[model samples]
Target chain A: MKRIALLGMPNTGKSTLFNRISGASARVGNWPGITVDLMSAKILMGGHIAELIDLPGIYDLHGFSDDEQVVRHFLANNALDLVIILLNSAQIDRQLSLVLQIKKLNLPCVLALNMSDEAKRAGITIDAHSLEQALQMPVIEISAKYGDGLPKALQAASNILNQVQQKPSPNTIRQLLEEDNQIEHEMERLIQQHVQIPTSLSNNATDTLDKILLHKWLGLPLFFLAMFLLFQFIFTAGKPLQDGLAWALDWLRTDVLEIAFASTPAWFHGLMLDGIYNGIATVAAFVPIIVLFFLVMAIVEDSGYLSRAAFLMDALMAKMGLDGRGFVMMLMGFGCNVPALMGTRVMRSRAMRLLTMLVIPFSLCSARLQVFIFMIAALFTAQQAPLILFGLYLISFITMFMTALLFQRQYKSVEPFILELPPYRLPTAKQILLRGWLEVKHFLNRATKFIVIGVVLVWLMTNFPSNVAPASAGTYAGQVGLLFAPILDPIGINQELAIALIFGFVAKEIVVGALAVIYGMQGDALMAQMATQIDWVQAISFMLFTLIYTPCLSTIATLNSESKSSAFMWLSIAWSLGLAWLVSFVFYQSARMLGF
Target chain B: MQLLSQLESGQSGIILAIEAEESLFHRLSALGFRVGKPLSLIRRANFNGPLHVRLGSTDIVLRIADAMRIQVNTR
Candidate 1:
């Protein structure tokens, strides 16, 4: 078996290429010393399997960041048979430094200059043969997104394995003096001799787009409008599909659920209808909207436009000690904070990485959207759902920004956002749609595991009158909530409802699942009644607090794993809890004073 | 004149010395940015955009003041 690792600086289409070769069969497991998992994919190159390891994007092996260390270890440990370096053609200078570092490892290597298609469009030209000779290695230029020349690149690696060539040079420290100067001088000479970098493209089409998109005077406004449109699409255009899913779930409850319980005893019947059936139904409502939102995000990221987004927003981030990497994580945060927090591996500075992780929990994840939309939809017409949803997102963005300012004030230093903005390509439809489907499938599977258990437990709580609570307290559900009513009184939520939301701490979706058990009889009426029990301040407080709270246990585990710092993990939990409490307390108290 | 980050985004400018000043443009220069090149600040995000710039045929996002430090002529 050949162990091959693909390494690159950020935005060289490394991950996209990995997806192409590995499909979705990659095994994701955490590596020691890093917060995120080291992802490996098995491609049967010749009946003998070749394991392709996708390391996080790293600029230099010397950096202290989690990603740099992983790549550094793999090289020093002789972890892989060979290393394949992906270089961004347009930004070859910055990328070549890493290639030089790897070459110093004495490993048999292949250079795949990805995004040649973009290179061509950008008016840059390279002499492939001369370039290969100058670097004293095999190099193939290909666009991972468009699938151009990828085969030949893979073929080169295959040739090395087929030859059983001289064992690759084991990476060790002899401290070669000429390494940096040699590559830089050679790359410059090579570019001078072969590559023709266009001095015009940036001023042409991209400039026109950036002029409107990144306008100093108009940039923020345009960015906001674009973001507004995206959010609107999630709630407005997404509603019909959401309602359709809800309708089908309701049908299942009335039709199949009732049929399954026809002759069953009271408790079994309750478990089936209110427990299992209800859990499935609540999860089902999100399938449509979540799929829509992720699909859009994937398409944007795949096409390389997200870099432009990072471009448009890089300045203000530096003020807070964040970089383009933090921006990218924040984008991913919109999908889910766990992965975004994990994705912070791209940020090399520990202090910046920690701050980014701390702030991400405050960004709204999609799971929270379902609850926000459903409740707000109940309070107003469907037209109002989008407006209200936008308001929540607005609140989230504002809160995140404010929190970051506070974080920045208490900080020392942060790494600059060093990002390569690749030329834009039309994202591959097959890949984008497939990735979106895979995410939805993953979420649904998790729903099956935890949601089913929580639903059944909540049903039993409501069913048992002579159960855990005092016998005179009626059902176990009411009695349990009664014991904790005073604790939630400040938020203005009654005991029963407050108890259910507290259950959400385990997983946000369970809040809806538990509420389903409590309010199944009322169906649509539950929203109205839920409102009466909690005033506007309390409801908004709930939304804000939940937004700022610790991400589910899964993210906490990822936080612990990725940063390799238990302190960062515990601090995330503690600080978020503290911030949420302070913010919600102010909101709740101030609202009552204003008499709403 | 030394800090690229001082330049506001959306300003079309010229690149000055990088890396020598420990600026993000220097990092980009290490990434592939060169001296004596035209640079422009595209747009900056509240927190995520490290630094957005338009140079030559490609767009680059660097840490802070990368473009700001590069002396440029803005019309």
Candidate 2:
């Protein structure tokens, strides 16, 4: 198969173009390194199955950044049929430098002037024919977002692949670096001759929006407002959808499944309904919340306000020895810590990535947030619920910041923060829906397998020693809970809660599911039962514990892979567990002392 | 002549030279901060934070310390 690598400066719409051409739903954020790892997809082009490799966006081939090194190393070590160098047509002058540098590799390449729609809208014109004449390569104008001119670009690339011989060489990097300024000069000359910018073309819209959004006084408050509304939407708007799903799942298990499995053995019925249905349904109920979250997040990110958020937060983030971009990753941690951990690949420094990874688990991921929301609804009044939830989010940020501050000194070197603020563009409905669907798909794919296995394990632990009543002291789960009862007693957690926490270690979404199974209640009945078992003070303590506890099994697996150090993984677990215990203990004790 | 950081918001300048250490220099230059490039300080974040500067069609935010290392001549 012909291998073609997509290369471009960060945020030049390369990943979007890749998705458009290959029909792969790779993440397309308005920020850099969204395609952190090299992503390849097989696309049928010109009646040929071509493998397209999407490289991480790079600013310079000779630059020392991690992404730059990945691009350089791949180009040097791998034999490529052709390279498609994407350039943001709106910023062709500065982006042209990279094009010149890539051309120095003497590889068979095509120049894709991406974002031509934006350029045309902004009244910036590029003479592609003249550029092709000067650069001695095919130049194609394309809009990756709308899938315009993609077939022609792919055909052009296929044509180049056939015409050029594969000259695999590792010496390209040294040659490119040795002739650095020459490339810059050539780029300057090309821009002077081929690209024309009208002085009347102004970015007044972006400028006007930024003035208000990035204003010193209004920036932070507006950001908080946006987040508050997002959570508000998740709870208020998502409730009916969540209830509908839960109702349907309950009807399936109780009304339909019980009738169908009426003659089955008691044990089989319990395993299928109590174990699998309850566990999967409990996690699945939150899918609406997750979908809504990703929808709002995709909109925010696509609007390019995410970078402005980073810009606004940079001053505060720097105090903790993290860059503004790390703050963006931490925010992403709210959706799912695994991808957020992977998102740390965008960080330029190893120390920065590690530091960000340590703090990400504290970001109150959707799983933990669902648990907290459940607790708040069960234990608190309607008016007090949002406030309590907001307070928990506040605590999450504080915990992450303090953790970064405490561990910042351990990593001696910190990368200086440098970020590009892309212009704010309204995300198309298609892009927003695609991004949300991708996230929900990811959550469901991971949740079904992890939650089912976790639920089955918990059911086994509670039901074994067959002579004993289910979930009673004679069961393995009850015995383990009792063993830890002494340590947990101070935090006011009962044996059932303790057992649920143990299951939660497998996946946080299973906490509520385990409780539902152990207590033999579902939906509102479970909420009522939980209300009777735990007081508001104890409930608050439990929420704190859940908020601070160790990362779920999947997050730990991601941390292990991304950090690639068992010691660091263990350190993270220990830090989170110790902090959770201490915080919950103090909260419970203090509430008692204050006569709550 | 002044440091890039000293240029107030809306002030335009031509980069004369970057006076940072080797790695920082290369990183800055890679982002089009080379000598003779025209840039303007779009805004300086509050609390002595990073400066938002525009070079050609790219808008970049860099720390105050990094801005100080880039020597520029006022337009």
Candidate 3:
């Protein structure tokens, strides 16, 4: 089997090409000991099985950017049969510098000019034959988006692989570390000789779009509107799917499964229905929202507005020691922290990524909002509920920013801001759907086990010894809650709420359900009983704790996987737990002192 | 020579020298910033933020602080 790696600057349609060739068989998994995963697929090329690896888009192989380092590391470690260097046909003047740098490595390579159709639309043309002669490598002009010239490109790669020359040594990469200022001059000369770009080309589409999109006054508002519509679409479209899944699961557990398991032991039935089935249901309910969120996000990212959004928000985000892209991820966190955390890949700087990860958990994701909404409705009047919810949002933002400001210094590295604004192009439906499906698949593969284990563990804790009532004072979960009751007393979280917090760690959406079960009541009855148990101040404190405590198990698993560091994951958990306790303690103590 | 950040919107300039650390200099050069290459400031973001710059049809967004490190000749 031969190996081929797709290398290119960003926005070069590398992923599109990989997806087009690999189709639905692409597999994304982390290489052993690598910090992040690269998408790879096994495809038959020219009657031979070949492994195609799609690397992260990099600006320069010799540069110190995180993505660059990743690419360089991958090249040094893996002996590839061919490196297909993809370049944007319309932006070849600048992109060719990377090609030259890679050429100096003396590796077997081919040059692929992608987006040739867009280049033709823009009145740009490249002399592929002359360029190939000059570069002494096969040059393939292909439009990955439109399926143009891809077969020829793959055939050229396969031809080179058939030769099977000796793999280049790692020392060639070290040789590229030396700066070569002459590559730019050579690139200019090559373009001047072979590339025919019309002088003073007018009727520019990107410029006209950028004029309005990046307008000094209108840019920020347009960005917010785009974000607003995106989230609104995700939720509006996803809500019905989520509700349908929830309804089906509930019906299955109660009506269908209850009848089927009538003859089984009561303990076995409860464990199967309440423990395993509930765990699977909780993870399944999130599928629609996660898939929809990434689908729209892919469209935005591919359309090139995502970088513009970053450009517009940079100055404001700079104060918190974050890149503008971090702001977008934080907003996405409000919907679901798991996807938002995965979305941090948009930011290339390691420091920005880590800092963003620290802050996103405090975004008051919708799961936590469910808990707040329930608590607010049960405790406060209709008018007061909205204002109190608004207050919680304010606290969320404050805590997010505070977290960023606090951790920025420790993670500070000299990461300069340099972002590319690719020309706008309508993303293909196939590409968007592929991205959404792959992301959902990845989420399911990586996060489902953690979520199921967490939910089942909580169930076990609340229903152990097989003698006592589930979630009752005699159970293991109840005993543990009592153990922490005194420690939590300062924040007004009693033993019952303490037990709910354990279930909340699995998922915040379960907090209300857990409370209802622990109290052995349902719906309105549980709300009335809770209204009599905890007052307004205690309710507010509990809400605060819910807002800032440890993220759900899936998010924790995502953090561990995304960061590829258990230490950072543990730190994130401890930090959020500490912050939640401090905030709730302060608020509860001050309110008591003020006679609220 | 004036800093790239000092160039007015819509004004084009020739790159002179980039006063930055090795990493940033390498990054800028790879993005087509050379001693004689031409680039234009498309726009400045609000509140003294990043500048939208175009170099040979490639548009880049750089913070004002980083933009200050790139020297260019307006003429």
Candidate 4:
């Protein structure tokens, strides 16, 4: 199969074209000896099965960004059949330089001008035929978002791959270095000859919108309002769907599976129903919220508001040794830390990315929110529940910034903050749904293994040896909890709650479920037991611990994969764990001493 | 010549020089910030954060620190 790679600058619609051609079979490819994963898929291009690799979007090939290095490294290692360089037709003047750099590699190439429709609307015109003749390559104008002229683009790529091989250019690096001085002149000449642009094209729409949206006084509040509405929408819309899913899973276990397992031993039944089924079902029920969250996030991202958000938040983030993009990633962490950690790829500097990773786990993600909500409702009154929950959120932010403040000196970012603000476009429904679906699929594929392993391990530790009642003091899990009892005593966490903490380490959503199993009850019964078992202060300490402790197993896996540094990931885990203990201890002791 | 960061919102300028590290200069140039190129300050974010500068037809958000490295003469 021929290997074709798609390369482009960021926001060039390269991903849209890749998805347009490859459809849903696209999977991430792990290049040999490289930690980076590139998205690639095998597709039948004009009756020839070819592997298409979507390389990371880069500004310049010689630049030192992680993405640029990944692209350069991929090029150095792989002998590609063809490289399809995609340029945004609306901004081809500066983007064309990438084509020149790729051409220096002496590889077979096809040039695709994406967003042709947008370019045309902006009163820009390109003589594709003249540009094709000038560049001596197949140049096609395509609207990747609308499926316009895509067949011709694919056919051109296929034709180039089938043509006879060109001899490798001798002294390619030296030749490229010599031509680098003249690259700008060549780009200008090509544009001068084949492209036309009105001197004062009408683009007041963006200006008017920015004036209001980025208003000095309103930008910050508007940003907060947007985030507030996003969560309100996610919860109000997602809760019913989630509760419905939970109900179905419960019915499946009790009504159908319970009868089927009745003839089996009690231990086996418990392992299947409570251990595997319950564990997996709890996570599965969260799928709707994740999907909705990403769907909204897709709109926020593709609509171009996210960049403005970064612009508004950059000053504050700069003080924390980060850029505005890091702040956006932190907010994303509130939905789920795994994706937010994965999203650290936006930061080009390693120091900034690592620092962002360190701060994300303290986001009080929806999983921990579930545990906190349960605890607050069980221990506090209706009036105080909201206040206490708000307090937890406040603590989450304080701790997150404190972590950044503490570590900014260790991980100082020297890279300049330079991000493009793409003109606002109405995001198409097709692209939004595709993005939402793909992210959800990615989440399940990467997170399922660790979650399953974590849940089953918790089950085994609580139910093993077939002697002691499940989750009792005689069990192994109880003994592990006992080992930490003394250290946890000062924080108001007993051995039983310590076991819940161990379960919470796997995933915070499981903490309440673990409490149910430990006390041998569920729903109101469990809440009643919780209220009698622990005071409001202990409940508050528990919530604090849950809020600040290590992120879920899946987030740890993502941190390790995304950062590609086990030491960094381990350090993040240790830091969060230590912080959680200290914070809980201080809060618990102070509240008691203050006569609360 | 004045720093690009010092330019008033809606003011246009010609790039004179970029006194940044090689990588950052290259990045700025790749985004169409070359000597003799014309750019305009679209807006300044609150608290002197980033300046939204328009180069050719592209809009870019860059920090004041980065903007300060570029010398520009207002038109």
Candidate 5:
């Protein structure tokens, strides 16, 4: 199959075009680096199946950023039949330089003057015929957002694919690299001749909106209020759906599974019902809340509020040696650390990317947040619950910044932070749902495999040595928990809690499941049992320990791949474990000394 | 002529030159912040934060320290 590469500067509507053509729901945010990884999908072009590769956006082919390098390496290594060089019609003067550079590569290419509709609304006009004449390539005006003039663009690319035969000579590329200034000058001349700009393009809406959203005093307050509302929405809106699912699971376990396996051996029933079903059901109950979170996050991100939040937090983040974009990724880490860690690909500097990755595990993702909510509801009164949860989030942010400060000296190279603030547009329902669906798919993909393996492992440790009582001190899990009891004893963690922490290494949500099994109760019964067993102070210490402990199995796997250094992976584990233990010990000891 | 950081909000200027490290120079230039380009200071974040400037149709936020290195001629 023939391959076509999509190339353009950041926020040029490249990914939107790719999504419309390929029918793949790659994230379409109004910010840069949303498509950090290359995405390819097979599409029928002129009745022929062709694979379209969507590369990360770049400003110049010779730029030294990570995204630029990814594009440069891909073009150098991949065999492509045609290149679709997209240019934002509104910013043609600045965007044309990249087109000129691509032309010097001697590859057959088509110029897509994208966002023509927006340009027309701004009272700018472009002569496509004149641009074609100057560039000696087919030029088509397109609006990827509204799906206008895309067929012509695709037809032009298909025609070019059939005609281009040979790669550009290395000597030609070298020559063009040496004459970069001349190329920019030529691009400026071409834009001057073919594009006409209006004298005054009104931006009253955006200006007014920025005044309030980016206000000196109101910015931080508004940001926190927005976040707090989002958190409240997730819980309030998701409670009914979560309760229904839990009820259904309970009925299935007691009514359906019990009757179906009535004649099976006792051990088999125990393994099936007490071990697998209960464990999985506990994790599944939190799925509704997680789904709602990503939905709200997608809406906020698509609406362009996240960039404002980043802008507002830049000064505070810089104190910890991070830029606003890094802070945005940390906010995303609150939802899930895996995607947030991947989002670090947007950072231009390698040192900054690594530094951001180190602190993300401290963000207290939803999985860990689930454990906190469960423990809080189990131990605290209704009014105190919100304050405790809020405290945990505050500590999470403080720990992340503190961790970054501790390692700031090692990463000395701070690249100049330059981010483009795209004009806000209302996100379409289809786009918003697509982002939510993609996030749900990612969560399930990671959750299913690891949750199943983790739950079954815990089950085996508790149920093995078939003669002993289930989850008793003589069982394998109980023995392991007993071994760690002395070390955790000072912090009020008993054998059962220690075992739950062991299972938590797989996924934090499993900690709740492990507790349910150890106590031999479910739902309100389990909460009641927990209340009787652990006091509020000990519960808070336990929550703190869980919040700051090592990243879950899936996160560690991603950290290894993104960081690409086993040494850093090990360092992350050692640091998080040591910190969690020290903090919990201090909290527990001090509270007891103060007569709590 | 003065540093861009010295310009108050809503003031326009022409970029005279940029004096910074090599990587920062390339980054700023690539973002259409070259010499002779007209730009305006939109706002400065509170507490000595980044300077939000508008260059052509694009709004960029950069550190105050980096903005201090960009020489501009206010008209």
Candidate 6:
């Protein structure tokens, strides 16, 4: 099987092409690393088993952005036999620059001129033959959306690897055009013969849609409308499934527990039924919402609207010392902080990326989202759950913005910003589901391994001091709790809550799992633990700390890889920990001062 | 020049410069909002403040002051 690496800037239809060839969304995201996440997919191209390594979206080989470096290093290593560069023909100039750079690498490459349907619709036409002749390489024109020219493109790629004969020289043009003016002249000539840019592609459908969707007065309304629909889709899609699963989990916990452990000792019964099954059930409860969220996010991402979102958010983003590109990383942070931090590689300046990485820990990932919702449901009513959950998100976002401002004042490095703005296209449903499932799978893997281990460890810590009778304070668990109690005192978290929260910090959903294991909560496991052990003020403090706390281990590793330095890696870890400590301290102290 | 929200869609204009009173001048320019680029107003945000405008195929959202500073002549 030949290995082909698909390369392109974000939103140039690489994912679209990959999806068409492989019958997969390949992964979620049209922008940057969201789709491939720096991994290769095993694909069969042309009835032959071939591995497709979908590299992250990168603008150039010259830059040092994290994913760029990943691609640069990968390409330079010459690990693959074929390279397919997808370009948006409509934005030919900007995308062509990348092609020009990729061409200079002197690799076996195929350039797929994508989005030709839109280009034609916009009155633009590309001469694929001219582009091919100009570069002395094969150029395939395809529209990944309309499924036009995909077979030809893939076949070209396969043929090039198989039956096609390469010229003896393969024609490496080092001084290809001789001068900048000559190069421009040649490019202009090629476009003049083969490409035509439309004067206007305006249509009443889009114009009418834009009137309401892109309305100045109504734009924001529409933006919120889009956002609300996304959230509604997530909630409505998952709520019933979540309820049925919860009912099944309840049966597993009680009826199944009684039958399975009827002959076991009390301690063993508690360990197997409450500790193990409880952890499993806790993870299962939120699985629906997490999967649903990822699905909607994948849809938004694959639709190419996420890039426009970055554009729409540039003003607010710039205010916080980030460019539109930084928002790309932030959106990734919504899935998990680790990738978001890793996504910061797109940021040019080390300082900006570092600062953004520091604050990203504040954004709630899907893992933590379930914890907040569970607590809200348990403490208040179910109706209040959504509002409080929404408030927490707002608080995290505002805090992240303010924190960015503060960090920028303390550092002075400028990031050279160049971005690719992709036109909106509907993402395929198959792709969204596939990408969302990968995320769901990753979360489940964590839940099974680290989360389960974390719960048991916390349970062991809190259960060891069973001195008085039914696990009293003299046990090892109580002793450890007493030991950590003072360390947590100033921060407003009790030792037990702190232990649980720390375990949760590994992956936020595990907090409930740990608490359930510790306190033996039923039904609404997370909320039950929070209410029984943590007061309202402490709960709020815990949530704030959770928002500002150290990123999960996966994020830590990703940050380390991005920074490529132990020092910078630890700096983020230390900064987030210190910030979480301070934020929680203030919340706890201020609340006490105000007689809460 | 009016804020981006005030401009009709598809209208083209040139950015004279950024008029931000705050510290957004350099940031905006770094993001390619420098003077002399032909910018088109796309959409505006809440209260005609933050505006979505395009420069060189890259759409950017900027505040009213940033938009106002980039003097534009409607075509």
- List ranges where model 3 is wrong by over 4 Å: A1-203, A259-261
Instruction: Write one digit per residue (lDDT tens) for candidate 1, span B9-75.
Output: 6566565555445655456676656767776766565444356666765666665444444554444
- Kindly list the per-residue Cα lDDT of model 2 for residues B29-51, writing each as its tens digit: 87889999999999878888788
Better of 1 and 3 by lDDT: 3
Candidate that scores best on lDDT: 3
State the C-alpha RMSD over the true interface residues for candidate 2, after superposing those residues: 1.2
| Full-model lDDT for every candidate | 0.68, 0.80, 0.87, 0.84, 0.80, 0.66
Estimate, for each residue in A1-596, the C-alpha lDDT of model 4 and write its tens digit.
88888999999988998998889989987985357888999999867889999998999987758897677667766667888999999888779989988876777889999988888986589999999988888999988899989889888987877777863433453455446536755776797788743233235687788888899899999988998898788778988998899889989988999999999998888788877886678558657866877777777777788899999999899898978878887987887787677667767899999999999999989889999888887888899989998999999999999999999999998777889887776776776787768877876776676667777887888887678887877788899888888899999999889888888877787788888888999998899988999998899998899899996877876777778889998999999999999999999999999997
For model 4, chain A alone compared with the true chain A gives a TM-score of 0.63
State the weakest 10-residue window (summed lDDT) of model 3 chain A.
A195-204
lDDT of 1 by residue, A46-76 (tens): 5569989898898877665777766665555
Candidate 6 deviant stretches above 4 angstroms: A1-211, A240-291, A324-357, A364-395, A409-418, A437-456, A463-472, A475-477, A506-573, A590-596, B1-75
TM-score of chain B of each: 0.63, 0.96, 0.94, 0.96, 0.97, 0.69
TM-score of each: 0.53, 0.61, 0.70, 0.68, 0.62, 0.50
Better of 2 and 3 by TM-score: 3
Better of 1 and 5 by lDDT: 5
Per-residue error for A168 in candidate 6, Å, reads 46
Q: Across residues A544-585, which tens digit of lDDT does each residue of candidate 2 receive?
A: 988898757667756777788889989999999889999899
- Of 2 and 6, the candidate ranking higher by DockQ: 2
Clashing pairs in 6: A338-A555, A461-A477, A464-A475, A464-A476, A465-A474, A465-A475, A465-A476, A466-A472, A466-A475, B19-B69
Candidate 3, A436: how far from true, in Å? 0.5
Off by over 4 Å in 2: A1-202, A231-241, A255-264, A272-291, A328-354, A364-394, A410-414, A440-448, A506-540, A551-570, A588-596
Q: What is candidate 3's DockQ?
A: 0.66
Order of candidates by TM-score, top first?
Answer: 3, 4, 5, 2, 1, 6
Q: In model 1, what is the error at residue A535, expressed in angstroms?
A: 6.2
- The digit string of per-residue lDDT tens for model 6 on A24-131 reads 435432323232245456676666677777777887655547777667555543345678998888878667888877666566788888888878886588888988
Off by over 4 Å in 1: A1-203, A249-254, A261-273, A276-286, A323-395, A406-415, A441-451, A454-480, A503-578, A587-596, B1-30, B34-57, B65-75
List, for all models, the DockQ compared with the true complex.
0.38, 0.55, 0.66, 0.67, 0.62, 0.16
